[model samples]
Target: MISANKLAGASSSDKYRQIHDAFEKTGRHWLYNATVGAGLPVNHTVRDLIDSGDTILALSGIFSGTLSWLFLQFDGTVPFTDLVDQAWQQGLTEPDPRVDLSGKDVMRKLVILAREAGYDIEPDQGARGVAGAGALRRRVRRSLL
Candidate 1:
C-alpha cells in the first residue's frame, strides 16, 4: 500500500501532487515522507539533477549510522566495532543489522535510482557487500584492545 518511488515528477511539488492524486484515486489515507527527516531526496532530486546535466552523487545507506560510520572507519578514526555499536544504539540499523551491512538495501536503492535515470539496471547488477557477517565479526574482534 505504501509506495516509495512509484510516481516521480520534475519538482518536489509536482511529485507531491502526483502522490496525492494517486492516493485520492485509491481512496486511501497515506503519509508521504520523501525528504522530511531522511536528509536526502533520493529519487525526485536525482531525476532533477540528471535532467539538468548536473552530476549527482548518491550515497545510499541504512537509516542508522552504518554508512557514515563505515566511512569514518575507513578513515581509521573509528573502529568497526564502535561503528556497529553506534548503529545499534542509535537505532539507525534494521532489526538485524546484517540486513544493512549486507549492502542489499543500498543496492536496491541504487537500482531504483538507476531506473529513474533511464538506465536498465537489475537489482542484482548492483555491487554486493564485500564484508559478510563473519568478516565483520573478525574485523571487530581485531579492533578490540
Candidate 2:
C-alpha cells in the first residue's frame, strides 16, 4: 500500500494504527511517502538511507511553494513587508501568510524528514528555527495577515 498524506508523522502512529496492524498481521508492506517537497523524492532518499543502514544526522531544504517564491523574490532593496504583500497579491503566499511565515508547515516537513531518518520525535520535541523566518513572520503578522 502507498500513502502520501503529508501528515509528517504527526500523530502518525495513532492515525495509522489500524493500517499498521493490518500490514503487520498480514505480512504486507506499507509504503508511506510523506510528501513535503511537493513530489520530490526526499522521503524516498531517507528511506533508502535507512534501509541501507546509513545514518542521517540532518536534513534541510525549502519545503514550501509559498516560501520558495517569497525567498526568490526577496532582495535587500525591498522591505520584507512589501515583498510579503506582493507575495499575497501574486498568490505566492498561503491563505494566511503568517502560516507560511511561521514555518509550521516547513517544520512539519522537517519532522517527517527526521522521522524518515529513524527519529521518533514530534515537531516540538525537536529544535526548530529558521534564520530569517522570524523576521518575515513578524513582518507578515504586523503588516499583512
lDDT top scorer: 2
lDDT of each candidate versus the true structure: 0.57, 0.73
Best by TM-score: 2
lDDT of 2: 0.73
Off by over 4 Å in 2: 1-4, 12-34, 76-96, 128-145
The sequence of per-residue lDDT tens digits that candidate 2 reaches over residues 7-124 is 5255554554566578899999766663566667777888899999999987766678888887787765688789899989988666778978887767767777787788876667
Q: What TM-score, to 2 decimals, does candidate 2 have?
A: 0.64
Deviation of model 1 at 71, angstroms: 4.2
What would the per-residue lDDT of candidate 1 be over residues 65-117, giving only the tens digit for each residue? 46656665565576666787777788775566775677654554555556556
Q: CA lDDT of 28 in candidate 1?
A: 89
Query: Which residue window of length 10 is worst by lDDT in model 1?
Result: 2-11
The TM-score of predicted model 1 comes to: 0.50
